[model samples]
Target chain A: MDFAAIIGNLDLYLQGLWVTVQLVALALVIGLALAVPLALAASARRVWVNFLPHAFIYCFRGTPLLVQIYLIYYGLGQFAAVRESFLWPVLSEAYWCALISFALNTAAYTGEIIRGAMAQTPAGEIEAARACGMSPAMTYRRVILPSAFRRALPAYGNEVIFMLHGSALAGIITIVDLFGAARIVNSRHFVPFESYITAGFFYLCMTFLIVWAFKFIERHWHAHLKPLRG
Target chain B: MHKLIITAFTAVLLAGGAAQAKEWTKIRIGVEGAYPPFSSMTEDGELQGFDIDIAHALCAQINAECTLVPQDWDGIIPALLARKYDAIIASMSITEERKKKVNFTNKYYQTPARFARRKGSGIEVSAADLKGRKVGVQRATIHDGFLTEVFGDEVEVVRYGSQDEAYLDAVSGRLDLLMADSVALMDGFLNTEQGGDWEFVGPPYTDVKYFGEGAGIAVRKRDNDLREQLNAAIDAIRANGVYRQINEKYFDFDIYGN
Candidate 1:
């Protein structure tokens, strides 16, 4: 194996790294926005209120993200009416198609995390808020959401890492994310194992950063829960 | 228990007979939908161009109903091997390295590989000029392998998943030059408004090392019969002028095996 060939295109590799960061950052923001409402509705006790998002979360989670990207980019593109529709402008670009798929996928997984955290929010705390004459909306806002968010942070961090890796699929759809850049290098060089390994190392670095961030958050959250003896 | 065992044996035998008698009424032919003028989808979502037309002619010749399966180029070879499709009619070049894993028919269409660069880009127009400059080609292609082997590590190589993507990037000033077949580069960048933006810069290059003689129908190596059938059909099409008619529809000149 020629080490120089692997190390030669550092600029291209860095550009790919930058694109990957952009994709993950954009998708994560949109994913969190969608996840919040879906998770709240899913945690609702009313059957009709919770059913739709539950089904959505299940379907998105069940299918592979690769298939989801294809269905969104190529499968939906097969329809002439869809091509002619007003939404065609957004759908025409491969970047948006990948973003939509990653956003929806992350939202499904994150929604479940948030919903489980909400369910674990103490009932006594909610009852105490109600006893204090707080309105239902106020009680949930002040008591439920904050607690659920704190509880959900660790799991949400893992989802963030997964989303970063998943955005690599954007490479296949012609998006020049970090992985896409690496693919370009590999294609040009015919050195798949090397290019992909370098790309994987970038992902591993990002994964470590994510873990560190979550660890810091966990420590900050538990500061008030320390034992009196300690 | 004896009666049940006899009934099970009879059922297994009947199922095996049904499996053996199943005829291939419908066949799937994988095409790279991104290679325009060869096998590309239109803005209106229809699969059009040369490969689509040629596949129809071949299917009629073989007396088999065929469906054009749109597969990504990188995955096309593996997908064919995995039996995701019965054959590949994509603009797949028949190379010796590829021949070890997959079989190919006689050359259906041959377009010499050319270097494409922006109108005034100082990037080299020749293989010797390519030293130290960045060039892009589609991955897993004979062109990519050719450049790597011939140019060595001196030239920077960029890979694109599809030809269109590479062209867009090259036009956007991301790549110094992009290389692909003359027929595709003609229909892709040269035939459009961007035709002025990019032009073929180098002499057409062809050899076993670079272009692999020409493009052909690709099937699994074990499927030698399918390879023979496709080669025969291609020969028939060429003899009757059907191949030239289809070639001239997309290209200004004939691209059928020079």
Candidate 2:
């Protein structure tokens, strides 16, 4: 079973796991932050306000993340202006390129999820908030956003896991995330099963933890919506 | 029910056709169309490279209709084993580790590995000198193995999916140095516009322990007859000056190593 190889490369696996976590966590936070505004703009009454955001959502969601990453990492580098620009320092690093691609890609999907949840918000609750003398901003902030977030939690959880898997593509761009480490081991030792199986185990562990955490959050956040027992 | 019976009969006939005995009449050859000077795609999607020419020459010698299948380098071996292609004519080095999984023809060519750094970087290519420096290499290559084995503790090895990626990183200054086949570096990168600022920094390394014998066409283990045929073709091309003709087209020096 080549237990020795797994044990020997444990540090590399952990380092890769650390990179994967950093990529997913940072991207998720940035994506959600960007998504909130995008969702609001997408749901606005003014056609002009929603147009660009809708286009952005469609472009990002429609294209493959791998192409987006390659464009940012290699495509941008092709331009003399990009190379000479102040942004070159960040753009030159594969780590930053991967993070930016992940953030942009996830923002589109999360924006749609939040927009859908906002659309599904009951008209009665919004009316009740307005009836209680709440301002438009207060009604959206206190009632609509909270309700939408709770509803979006389950779907958002899936996006989180999807992003975790998507982060594997970071390896292609030269960032040694979990999949990269496995690839290194596989190439070096020629033990594909042992090398990849160990990485898979780590991914499975991460997935389980994510699922458990989301379940815990869902239980508390959606307590009011839970069915009653006799 | 009548239509289902007809469909079943057609399926059986197709299966019977596929199970027929192998004639070396038609052979599918896999090539990584990304590696330039050896194998690369033109702007109009034509595969043009020294390796492609060599594959054609070999196919002609054996009187077979050859088909070139472009595949990503990482999955090239597995694709061969799965019968996605009958053989790999990519610039795949003949190594002991690879020999365990697939059989390789006699080497078509060999070249030493070399390291390159920016013209004014002043970074010496050595294990001690490269401490903590980021060195770029194409993943799943002999150079990657050599770098990791020798300088792994002293330097950070950044593995890219393709040689071009490593070249890009090196030119962008993200990588302190890049290691790859000497001829490939010269033809594909160092002689190009973006790579104009880079130059080889160390003596060419050709230790057989890591670099292996040379680049060879790889076929599945069960394809011994095909392997023998390819080896004979390689010898025929080399003897008849055809190998030198292709070599002169791509490289000035003899790429066939001692």
DockQ of 1: 0.12
**Positional deviation of residue A4's Cα in model 1 after best superposition, in angstroms:** 21
Candidate 2 local lDDT, A130-149, one digit each (tens): 99999989998999999899
* Per-residue accuracy of model 1 over A1-230 as CA lDDT, tens digit each: 54465688888789888888877888899989999999989988899999999999999999999999989876777676887788877886677889899999999999999999989988899999999999989988999988898989888998999899888999886677888877766545545567888899999999999899888988888677667674
- Residue A59, candidate 2: alpha-carbon lDDT: 99
Query: Which candidate comes out best when scored by TM-score?
Result: 2
Cα lDDT for residue A173, candidate 2: 85
Could you give me the TM-score of model 2 versus the true structure? 0.88
- DockQ, per model, reads 0.12, 0.42
Off by over 4 Å in 1: A1-152, A166-223, A226-230, B1-25, B126-132
The best candidate by lDDT is 2
- Tens-place lDDT per residue, model 1, B1-258, is 999999999999989867634544567899988988888898898898899999999988878899888998876776787789988998888787677667888888888888888887766665577777767788778887877787757687666678877775565444677778877888877878756688878788888666786888888776666777788889888888888888778877768755
lDDT measured at residue B127 in model 1 versus the true structure, 0 to 100: 58
Q: Is the docking of candidate 1 incorrect, acceptable, medium or high quality?
A: incorrect
State the DockQ, from 0 to 1, for candidate 2.
0.42
